[model samples]
Target: DAGVTQSPTHLIKTRGQQVTLRCSPISGHKSVSWYQQVLGQGPQFIFQYYEKEERGRGNFPDRFSARQFPNYSSELNVNALLLGDSALYLCASRATGTNEKLFFGSGTQLSVL
Candidate 1:
């Protein structure tokens, strides 16, 4: 069994560009969620997808969106990035229909210049 995994451990971009982050959930998991952690702040939920549908969302702007594939992999997209968007984009997953503990990947560190 493999834990969750994310691509591009680190990323650098200038303001106003768009970026996409990827995530692959652990085996047998059906729910994937996206979170953003700014410097010195706890992770804040961005979006959650379960069974290929949006399950939950946080207080984020329309620029933030995500979707879970049938294979349980997920991608988070951010458009018109702002300096405030620079943060550790963490991807988490849990078993379906249960509040089980989430498995978090190291995350893609996005740095907006």
Candidate 2:
């Protein structure tokens, strides 16, 4: 069985542009969450979806959004990217909700110029 995976290990973009990052959850997992980690900072939750329905969300701006698919994959979309948006976008998945152990992918490192 494969663990969580993310695409485009690194990304570079300019301000005012948009970017989309992808994630695939572990087998048999139905919940996928998106997080952002700034340089030297801890990961902050962005959004979480379970069974294709949004289960939880964090203190993120409208520019950040995500959705889970029926196959348990997910995508994180950021609109109107800013230089401050440069960070590592991490994807985490859990077999179940509440206190479940989360598995994370290395993440897509986004750089805004």
Candidate 3:
């Protein structure tokens, strides 16, 4: 089964443009989460969705949003992007059980010029 998949692999946008990144979870997984990783820092949790319901959100501003589909695929959207928002947007997924290990995708590299 696949671990996780993210689309567009890379993106380039202006400071005020908006962008959307997509992800597909592994088979038998019901939980999907998003994270942002700056070049030299650990990934920061952005949002998490389980069973198509919002479960958690991080300290990111309102410009960030996400949604999970019935099939467990998800999308992360960012509005009014800023240069500071440039980073690797990662998608992670885990089985529906306690202590399940998370699996991550290669991520979408967003560059705000």
RMSD of each: 0.9, 1.2, 0.8
Q: Supply the TM-score for candidate 2.
A: 0.95
Ranking by TM-score: 3, 1, 2
- TM-score for each prediction? 0.96, 0.95, 0.97
lDDT of each: 0.93, 0.93, 0.95
Better model by lDDT: candidate 2 vs candidate 3: 3
The whole-model C-alpha lDDT of candidate 2 against the native structure comes to 0.93
Which pairs in model 2 have colliding backbones?
none
What is the lDDT, from 0 to 100, of the residue 79 in candidate 1? 95
Clashes per candidate, residues 3 or more apart or on different chains = 0, 0, 0
- Tens digits of lDDT, candidate 3, 8-113: 8999999999999999999888999999999999999999999999999999999999999999999999999999999999999988875967899999999999
Residue-level lDDT tens digits of model 2 in 1-113: 88999998999999999999999999988889999999999999999899999888899899998888879999999999999999999999998755878999999999999
Candidate 2 stretches with Cα past 4 Å from truth are: none
Worst 10 residues of 2 by lDDT: 93-102
lDDT for residue 26 in candidate 2, whole number 0-100: 93
List residue ranges in candidate 3 displaced over 4 A.
none
The local distance difference test score of model 3 is: 0.95
TM-score of 1: 0.96
The pairs that clash in candidate 3 are: none
